[model samples]
Target: MSEGRPRLNTEMVRLGGLIKQAEQALITAKTIALKQFDLTVPQYAALFVLGTTPEASAAQLARACLVTPQTMATVITNLEAKGLVDRSTSPMHRRLRETRLTDTAIPVLEGADRAAVQIEEALAVEFSPEELRSLQELLNRTITALHQLG
Candidate 1:
C-alpha cells in the first residue's frame, strides 16, 4: 500500500507462524511435565516463582506472574492444598501474608527444574550456542517491549 515500498506480507506471515509454533511448543512441554505432579500450569508457575523468590506474597506473586490478585489467590490456595507452599503473616506487615516453599516443595521444584532443563536441551539441540544466545537476546528484548506496551 505504500507508494514505493513493497508489502512485507511474507515476512509478517513467517514471523506470525513461528510465534504460534513456539507458543504451542512451550505449552506442550509444560503440559507433559505437569501431568506427573497433578499440577496445572498456573500452579507450577506459582511454585517456580515462589522457589525463585522465597516468601513472596500473593500480590507479589500476582505481579510476577502477570495475573490478577484474585487469580493468584486461587493459585496460592491450590498450591497450599497440595502442601507445596506455606503461608505466613509477614513480620513487617501483619495484614500481608507471604508464601514460602515447604520441605515437600523442594523436591517437587527440583523435579520441575530437571524437566524444564530437558525441555531446554531439546530445543537447544536445534541451534548452535551462538544462535541460542542470539535467540535468548531477541526473546529478552521482545519480552521487554511487550511488557512496556502492556
Candidate 2:
C-alpha cells in the first residue's frame, strides 16, 4: 500500500450495500402490497405526496418524489386517466397546471396508506423504540452526508 493512501473501510462498504438491498426490498414489498389497489410504487408515491400537498404541480411533485419531470408528467397523466387525480390550470398561474386527488382517490389512497403502514409496522416491531429512534437519526444523517457530497 502507498504510504499516503488511506485504508478502505470494508464495514462502511458493506453498510452501503445493505442499505441499497434494504431499499429494494422495501420497494418490492410496497409493490406487492399496492397491487391490490391497482397502483404502482411511483403512483403511490405521487398520491402520498398529493395527499399532503393538494394542488401541487407536476414539477413540485417530481421534486418531492425525487423523480424527473418527464417521469412525473407521465405519472400525472396516468393518474388522471384513472380518475384518481384531477389536473386543473393553477388559479395562481393560468398557464401552469396543478394536480389534486379526486374524491375517488381518497379511499384508495387511504387503503394504500394502510397497506404501507403494515409493512412499516412489521419492521418496527423488530426494533425497540429507542433503537428505532436512533436508526432513524442515523439514516437521516446518512442522507444529509450524501447530499453534502453532491
Q: Stretches of candidate 2 above 4 Å error?
A: 1-12
Model 1, residue 122: displacement in angstroms? 0.8
Across residues 1-150, which tens digit of lDDT does each residue of candidate 1 receive?
779997766645575478789988887887797778777777778889988899999988998987899999999998899899999999999999999999999888888777777877888989999999999999899888878989
lDDT of each: 0.86, 0.94
Q: lDDT by residue for model 2 over 83-128, one digit each (tens)?
A: 9999999889899998999999999999999999999899899999
> Which window of ten consecutive residues has the lowest lDDT sum in model 1?
8-17
Clashing pairs in 2: none
* TM-score of every prediction relative to native: 0.80, 0.89
The CA lDDT at 85 in model 1 is 94
lDDT of 2 at 60: 95
- RMSD list, candidates in order: 3.9, 2.8
